[model samples]
Every structure is written in structure tokens, then in C-alpha cells.
Target: MTSPPQPAAGPVSPLNSPLEPESNRKLAMLLLAIVLYIGVLLLPTPAGLTPAGQVALGLLVLVVTLWISECVSPANSAVILTGAAVLGLMGKSLTPGARPMKSADALAAMLGGFSSTAVLLVAAALFLAVALKHTGLDRRVALLVMSRVGISPARLTLGAMIVGLVLALFIPSATARVGAVIPIMIGITAALGLPINSSLGATLMIVTAQACSIFNMGFKTGAAQNLISLDFMQKAFGRTVTWSEWFLTALPFTASMSVVLFLASLFLLRPQVPPAAEAEAKLRAQLAELGPLSGAEKRLIAVAVLLLVMWSTEGVLHPFDTTTTTQIGIALLLMPRIGVMHWSQAEKLVPWGTVVLFAASISLGTLLSKTGAAGWLAQQTLGQIGLSALPVVMVVGALSLFSIVLHLGFASATGLASTLIPIFIAFAQTLPVTKETAFGIVMIQSFVVSFGFILPTNAPQNMLCYATGAIRTKEFAKIGLVVTVAGLLLIMLLSATVWPMMGVL
Candidate 1:
């Protein structure tokens, strides 16, 4: 009656049966992330270490822990990590002559990120994204491009990439670009008479994400996070990156990578055939009935262009700095009560969590450097590797890969960059790679971190496409791997030759 020695008859089963293959895979990844984190601790170099090392090690630990827990959402993880780091500082881990945590001081430090120019820009970008959605400006623009390039699925994918890149200049957030482009992509699939679930659409989404991340380098306001990286470079290495100079150096590489990404997508995304001529005609008629750009759309477009002109001609007009651009742009849109979207509407459009993440990540980066964690990390990890240009390149590549793989578990691109770029700077200095190589690699990471195709969470855009079931997991894997490899190679080539010539490194 005692359960007859249940499970003793054979090898006892786990209380929770051994994980399924997928579960086991996840478990392995979690374990691997932990192991890599510990490796960060053991690394040592010639430069004697300090409190900075401890902070960097702590950050690595925090990232792995968040990955394991699936904690307070992806963006929130940044807030938590930053908060923890600041608390640790107050606990004598960061500051010497340590005193009890001051509520006023901690509050100021934590709030500093929210008050940063970058966060405001992202908030404004998100608001504009909402306005774009309400007025259907993005859809109209994307569909028009599709109509012109509808001859082939490959061409359509390229067109989507172009549109995303163009938008990247106006919309600083990857999330905003993805949100804007996703509906238009779906509309294109439906209009082409192709299966809504075709791999082609998924591929197109990936292209948009990657291209958006890559081409963002061409414009100062393209990615708010890039400014963080630039700030670190300047503060750490005494380098100044002018908007025009950065654009000049980054454009060729971004352009080259875009072309390569287009080809890679074409090879990977095999599309289903288009619908019958009559069906296509009927769909076109329905789309036409929706009518041309509404007055609201025109107004939104004008505001967007006005914002762009300000960002682009900042040197000429010099009205407000990049930071003020966000506040100004949002005010212009929100004040005018632009079309259907009122000031209240802007509230919903902005991802406050993301803004918080931006703040938190910047705060974290600042702490790492201020606490000397970054320098310690550089000494420990890269110090022993031997100073050589090749070794530095290897370090950059390794860091890029590390950030990218971590992206699988992260839902926010800014969050991923915020967590990893500080660690990267720590290690980058130890390498013999030129300044340009280091900068380019770090920039490339903004693109690589969003590159995976394995799951919907890899990027917001991918998730949107996945919702349509247009992409099989296997298809995403194949396309993602190819694009990822192409991106790395392009980064390497540019770092080796192009960036150096531009007087960057």
C-alpha cells in the first residue's frame, strides 16, 4: 500500500521529468551564460585591478541573472541592474570613504538617466511612431514602395530595408522603426497575393531590423544608444566625434553592409507565389478605396520632416542641440494636437519602460567607468592577451558575438546595448586595435545584437512578423545565421580598412 517503491524499480525519474529537448536547450544556454560570467571574474591582466573590476564583474553577473529569471520585463531589467549597481556603490563596493546610502543622492543618480537627452529623444521618437500609426503614414509610404518594386520578393525585401533605413534617421528607436514598418510589411504580403505566412515577410522584417540598426550610424539621431557609446569613447579615450565626421566615416560601411544584407535576404527568404491577377486587382482596388494621404497624414509628415531638417541642419541653424530636438519635436506634435493624436495620445505611444531602460543603462555605464570597473576589466581580460592589432580585432569580434547571442534572451535592443557596451569598453582598451577599429566594432554591435532569427523575441519586428506565423523557426534560423555571418564579415572588413582611413582609429 506504500506506493510500491514508486520509481525505484528503474532509474528514478526527476520530480519534474527531465526537460524536453527545447527546455533542455534553454537550460544549457542559461548554464552557458553563467559560466561565461564567471570567466569574466577570473580574467586578469598587467594593469593592477581596482573597485572598477568588481563593478564590471557584478554587471556581468546581473545580466546573466536577469537572463535566467526572465525578470521584470526586458526593459525593466536595466532599471533593476542599474539600481542594484548604485546600491552596491552605496554599500562600499563602489565609493571609498563609504557612507550610508543617501536618499537624495541615489534619487538624483537614478533620475539622471531619465533626464538625459537620449531618453527624451527616444520618448519623442516613440510618440512620433504612434502618430505615424494613427495616420497610416508608414503604411502609405511602404505600400507605395512595394508597388514600385513588386516584381520580386527579393526586391520587396530590399525595399523594406530602404524604407526602414530612411526612417531610422527620423525615428531613433529600433522599436519605433519596427512598429512603423511592421503593418506595411503585412499589407505588402497581402497585396502581393502571397501567403501571409510566407517566409518572405519574416525575412523582410529581419532585414528592416538589421538595416535600421546598421544605417542608424549614418545619422546622429538614428539610435539614441549610439550616443552613449560615443560618450564613453570620448570620456575614456579623449576622442571627440562630430556628427558630420561620424556620418562620413560610418556611411560607406553602413551602405556596404546594407547591400550585403539585401543579397543575403534574397538568398534565404523564398517567397510563395503571388495571388491571381484578378485577386491582386481586387486587393489593389480595396487599398485604393482607403484613399490617399489624409490631412492628418500630411500634417504628421510635415512635422516629421521638420524634425528631420532640424537634426540634419543642426550645424547651420544651431537652434537647439540634439537633446533639445526631442523635446521640441514632441512639443510641436503634441501642442498642435496634430490631427487625430492629441497630447493624451502621445502618452500611450511612448514606451515609458524603454525610456527608463535608457536612463538606467546610461547610469550603469557611468557607474562602471566612474567606479573604475571598466579599466579593471580592460586590464584583466585584455592585458594578458598580448598587445597586438590582431588580438584587438579578435576581442572586438568576440564582444560583438557575445552581445548578439545575449540578444536572444533580451527583448529590447537598447537594453542589450546598455548592458554590454560598458563591458566592451572595459575590454576594448587592452587590445592593440586602433581607435577606429574599436569604435567601429562597438557601433557594429548595435546592429549585431538585433540580428538573430531564432525566435520572435530576438527583435520587436521579428515578433510582429512571427505573430502572423509567416516564419517557421527553422526558416528563421537559416536566414538569421546567414545574415549574421554576413554582418560580421562586413564589420571586419570595414574595421580593417575603411574606418582607419577616415581618421577614426
Candidate 2:
């Protein structure tokens, strides 16, 4: 039977008609952001406006394009931005030698992002996720989770979130994390006699929120974009975001956010009591279905632990670090003897588009820095915006907010980070805050880029989780709003007081 047509919100104006309202909004937003970007570029600068302004303008254009189509593919958008930069330089709009836009050099420069430990680590982690899935290890674990954890509705939701977060440390990709876990979550929730829609909805939203948030803090290779942001900060400012330091800086926020999320889940998904017999039977069924761990699972666990040990003690463990761990894992993945991931399967597993997007975005950021575009814009805009510390704080906050909003349009975190970090770095140049503070804010923004409460295209993981229908739009909004605000505040406190006391300032 055909489903009834949904009711319209209001009489649709030409601008609001369903035929292309969203696309039109996206077009308008893209154009407006581009216009604002040009304004930022034209603002008076010490060097008579640098190429960084044009670079920033190009990024704004990309962001707009992404918001509209939600299908341009972030990597392609990055490539286009690079092309625009070259054209601008060629046409003298960005100044001669403003950026290395030659195809050969830009291609080479963009590829450098792949060499980072962060990228390799994530690739390793993806292999690990695939291995677990292929071997049925994840199902076994999920079964154990449902049986060992209580069947109470509230506990189940929390359990699912925890599972998703833990998996992310090893899984790397949000899509994989949710894709692997949501089906299992739905099965377990249904077995417990809970409403699939509301329970699953809230749980999945929490999963997306927690996965992105914790990964932002947990490992060096937690997320691809985290590495991109780190690379930009270190290359531009000569700083290293050590795993220990990253964890320490993000620990308080992570813990606070996790707890807040748990409470938020409870409130949003009010768990009514289920029939005791039915719940126990469902739990028993799930547990009974689980079998012994397979060879692949055993092998993967051993390899994963080895990788973790190496990550935790990179300095002392035979000079291995995140990159080495990833390389080793990938090598194992390609080995026929391992039988974990064949070359063909492994090739499919790597998110090559994401890798390309990172490389291109970084190249763009680098181009801005080289052309003196970033510094010029920083001097022009920050000088007029405010000369005081408080104003700088507000600017950082606003940038963070802009990044989050841009998430609705940009599908990838690295895309947003690479596009914005250079501009932020430039702006911070005029402020009194240390480079670390500015970069730290940028790092925080990268994490927040995974936020997507309303639309499916916000992030890959968000879309994957949303497809499960476990979380509703309103429910996501309620929890996401709280997390977003709290997360921003946590960063503000850390940047303003904690980091200052630690001499990061």
C-alpha cells in the first residue's frame, strides 16, 4: 500500500517550494558565505590583502557548495577549491606566487596528509573493524553485551553507547562504528520488547555524539580529521599534539560530556518497565545465539593489542608510533597468510576519498599560509574586530560555531578543519592567545564538525545512525544541543584558564 502524503508545513512560497527549496537554501547560503568571504578578503591588510583572503574565499565557496548538493563528495570539493586557488593565482586575483597551485605540486602537497600517522592509524583501525565484522567477532561481543549487561531499558541504551565508543577506538570510522553496532542494537532492543523507533533513535544519536566526542580525545588516530588538524597546527606553529597531551587536554571535557550524555539519554528515552519474563527470554535468546570466537577474531585481537601497546609507548617501543602501528596493520591486512583482509577487500576498506580530501584541504591551508593570505586577513579583520583578549575569545567561539553549522553542508570533518584552521590561525596571529590556544580551538572545532542533529548529510556516521531510525530528529536535537553547548563551554574553560595555567598560553 502507498503511504499517505505528508502534510506541508505551510503554503510554500517560490523560495520554499518542495521542488528545490533545500537546494535553493543551500545555494543562497553558499553565495552569501562566499560574499562574506570576499568581504573578509577585501578588508584592508598590511600587505595590501594577501592570497590567504582568496584562499579563505575559496573555502567559503566550497562550504557553500557542499551545503547545497550534499553530494559533491568532500574530496572533489577540496580538489575544486585547489583548482580555484590556482586559477585565482594565474589570473593575479590571489597575487603571483600566492600559492603553489601547479597541478604537479598541488597533487604532491595534498598527498602528504596520507603520510601522517593519524591517517595510517585510522587505516589500521578500519582493517581491524573489517576483520572483526567478517569474523563475526562483533556479533559475539554484542551478544555478550546484551547478556552480561542488564536488560533494563536505560542500561541497554547506555550499554549501546559504551559499545559504540569502545569500538570507535579500534574502528576509526564513525560509519563503520555505527553500521556495525546499530543493527545489533536494534536486535537487542527489540528482543527486550522496547519500542524500536524511540529507543533506537535516542541510543543511536547518543552513539554518534559519544563516538565523535570520545574519539576526538582518545587516540592519536582516533579520527582522520583530528590528525589533519594536528598536522596543520604542528606544521604551521611547530607544535606536537602528543597522545598524552591530547588526552589530558580533552579528558575533563570527555568525561564531563560522557556523563552528561548518559543523563541526557535517560531523560530523553524514559525507560518504562518491560515484562520481566519477556525481557529475560530475549536476553537469553541473544546470548544463546553467540558462538565461540573464530580464528580471525583471535588474530585481530592479538594484533590490535600489539598496535595499542605500540601506540601507548611509541617512544620506547622500538621507535614505533601511530604510523608504524598503521603500517604494520595494513601490511598484515594485505598478507595472504593472515586471511584477515585480502588486497581487494583492503583496498575497498580505506576511505580514499577522505584521504584525498584531507590532502587537498591541508594543501589549501598550506597555500594560504605561504601566500601570506592568512596573516594578511588576520591583521585586517582581527584589528578591526577587537584589540582585546575577550574579543579574541569571542572570535574563537564564533569560529567554532561556524564550523558546527557548516557541518550541515560539509560531509567530512577534515574538509571543515582544513578549510577553517588556516583562517583561524591567521586571525589568532593578531590576538594575544598563544598558537596552541588558537590551534586547540581549531582542534575542538574539528571534533564538533561531526555534529549533525537535523540532516542526514551532517556526517557519515550521523547518516548511518540516522538510517536505523533508532533516533528521531527531535531527540537528536535535544541531546545534541546540550552536548554542543557543554562541549563549547568546556573548551572555553580549558582554553581560558586551564591551558593558560599550564603555560600553553
Candidate 3:
């Protein structure tokens, strides 16, 4: 006999199901992190930490968790973190025998990120990128470079990487560089009649992303984290790392790694359709169609050249820092009819989320350093590693590797640096090395933190390319693993040889 029919199934309950909307899941995560924060705060203070430090640690734990989970937008998380810090400081002021931080000091600690030179520089750089895009200069540069490289896919890849390197020198923001380049590369792909998800398209996208990340290490202003690292160096070690010094120290390693990345992409991620004679014809046609640069492009070039000169000579000719010089460039760009673009146009291109995220990260990092939270955390974690018993080079390598592994949980390079740099500073002191050597080790660790290419969420550059649908996760992972391993080995080599020769060791 046939079995009786089952009753019709009812709608699934949200309380018992995992299939909630993404927004709902994110909200749950945010609430869970808040609860964790409260639990940590209410628990007894751990040894070797002040009450204020304990509070700061709790906030840091919550923020890091939220960031890693991406339970909220980074900007929103930053705002929440800043508010929590202010409240935590206020609570400390009310505690008996606590060293009460003044309200002004607390405000500064919570909101000072907005006033950072790095943040301002990034803002100005956004405007500059907009100017380049608005005047068609970015596209013109891309076509010019591609036209000269011929129609071979490998040659085009090299040309794109070279353009990325050149842009890194002047642009100073990896996201902006990717923003400027991806569209041009996409145009090239379309001109060649290649599908967006074709192997060639994927290769070009990955190359652009990888090149942006690799070259970020070559220049001090290439990434926001580089500036954060320098700030930490000056504050914690009484040492200043000028742009020229950073370029001198990091260029050797970055240039070599970039070559490895290019070769790896060429060999491992070879395109499905190699560039043909028609591809060259298409590029030339595109160039011929655009004809010559406009008056706007000419003015932008002058302004960009002036900005580059000022940045390269920051500590030498003018004594104006990178931020000051950028401000000057922005002023010229926005000045009357002579300006390349109006404020309205430039403002539209600015990535405001990045601005808020970096500012809050800097503020949080400053608090972590000032309140001794970073030091205590470092001592508790690395202190147990018995680093003193290991060779100095070995210790540096371990720390560098740890920084790379840690990036799996961090979406923002600035967040990773802000969290780890202070701890590395403390970890350096525990090593059997000179103060200068320790400083150098910390700087090296800072550089490795930028190697967040293994996952799409690791860096914005990766995420942007991933959005193109040209690359599959496994495809990216395959290349990312090779590059990451190569990068780690290179860092180890530098720590053993180049760093010592440079007196960083």
C-alpha cells in the first residue's frame, strides 16, 4: 500500500535556519561581537595590563573580529570603534585611582585620525586620480604604453606591469592605481574581442592587481600602511624614515618580486587567445581615434610632474612633506579655470570609505600604542615564543611569516599594520639585537604586512579584480600561493643579506 502523504511544509523559521539574508547575518555578527566586547570588559583584568589597557584590548578584539568577519562596512566599524574608544576612556576617568585621560585628550585619541597627514594625502591623491580620469590622461597613458609593447600577450602583460610601477611612484595609492588601470585594461580586452571571463582577461586583471600590490612596497607613499609604518617607527624608535630612504631600502626587493610575479603570471596563467596582429591594429586604431592629448591633459601632466618632483624631494629641496606637497597639487587642481577639474567632479571620484577607514585605523592604532595595549599584547604573545633563544634572522623570518598568515583575518592593510606594527615594535625589544637592528626588523615586518594577496578580501586591489568575474577563486589562489611563497622567501633573503648590508640589521 502507498504511504500516506506528508503534510505540506511550512515556511522556514529565521530563528532556526542558517539561510538568512546577508544583512541579517551581518547584523547577528555585529551583535555577537558587541556581546564579546562586553564580556571581555567585564572579566577580570589580565596581568601586565592596566585597566585602561584592558579596556583598549577589549575594544581592539571586538574591532578586529568585526573587521575580519566584515559584519559591517569598514567605515561603519571604524565609527563604532571610535565611539567605543571615547566611551571607554570616559569610563576609565570615572574609575577609582585610574589615571584619568582628559576629555580633550580622549577626543584627540578617538578622532585624531581625521587630521592625519596620510589621510589628507590620500584624499588629495583621490582628486588627482579623478583629474587623470576626467581629462582622459589615464586612458591615453595606457594606450600609449600598450601600443609600444606590440600585440604579444606576454609583452602586453609586461607593459601593464611597467605602467603600474610608474604609476605607483606618483599615485601613492594602490586602490587608485587599480581604479585607473582596470578600466583601461578592460577596454583593451574589449577591443581584442576577448570575453570578460576569458583567460586573457583574467590574466590581465590579476596582473594589474598583483602589480599594484607588489609595487606598493617599492615606494613609501604607495600604500597607506607604508605611512603608518613610518609613523610608528618615528614615534616608537625616535627614527624617521624619509621617502628617499624607504625607496632606497625597499626598491631592491620590490623590483625583484615584481619580476617574479610577472613571470609567474606569464607561465601559470597564460591566456586562452594570444594577442594577434589584429590586436595591435585595434590598439593603434584606438590611439589614432583619440588623436592628441587635450589642453586639460597637458595641464594635468604638468601638475602631476610637479607633484612627483615635490614628493621625491620631500626631505631635500623644499622641506615640504608628502602631505603638504599633495595639498599644493590639489589646490592647483581646484584653482579657478586653470584647474584640470572642478571640486564637484573630483569629489565624485573620491573613495570616501577608504578615507574614513584609514582615519579610524590610525586613531585606533595611536590609542593602542599610547595606552600600552599593544606592548602588553606583544609581550603576552611573542614573549612566550622564546625569540631570544633563536637566531635573529630566524626570529625575523618567523615574525614576517606570522604577519603574512595574520593577513588571512585582515581585509585592510592599514588595519593589519596598525594592529601589528606596535606589537612588532615591542617584539623587537625582546630580541638580542641593537636598537637600530630591532628597528630594521620591525620595518621589514611592516613591509611583509602588505603581502595580502592570498585571498580576495585581503586587499582592495584583489577584490576589485575579483569583481570583474574574469577570475575564479581557485585560479587566483593558484597564482597567489606561488607569489606569496616567493615573496616570503625574498623577505627572508633580504633580512639575511640586504638588510644587514643596509645597516638595518
Model number with the top TM-score: 3
- Model 1 RMSD vs true structure: 6.7
Ranking by TM-score: 3, 2, 1
TM-score pick, better of 1 and 3: 3
Q: Tens-digit lDDT track for model 2 on 98-204?
A: 55446555445445555665555555666777777776777666666656677665667667766765676676666666677777766665665667675544564
Q: Which residue pairs collide, candidate 1? A: 45-380, 52-372, 52-373, 197-470, 435-505, 436-505
Which ranges in model 3 have alpha carbons more than 4 Å from their true place?
Answer: 1-20, 93-105, 272-275
lDDT of 1 by residue, 1-505 (tens): 5555554456545645664655666566555545555465556623554444464556657665665445446575666566555554453433544554454565465566665556666677777777776777766676666556554667677788778876776666666677767777776666666666666666766666667656666676677666666655565667545455566766886787778777777766755446435434644664696698787877777877777776666666775666677577667766654544787766866777767766777776777676666666655654655543454455556666666677777765565666667766666655556665666556555445545444556666566656666666776667667666776776667666776576554
Root-mean-square deviation per candidate: 6.7, 6.5, 4.7
Task: Look at candidate 2 and tell me the lDDT of residue 222.
Answer: 66
TM-score for predicted model 2 compared with the true structure? 0.81
Provide the clash count, candidate 2.
4
TM-score against native, each model: 0.79, 0.81, 0.91
| Cα lDDT, model 3, residue 404 | 89
lDDT per model vs. reference:
0.64, 0.63, 0.82
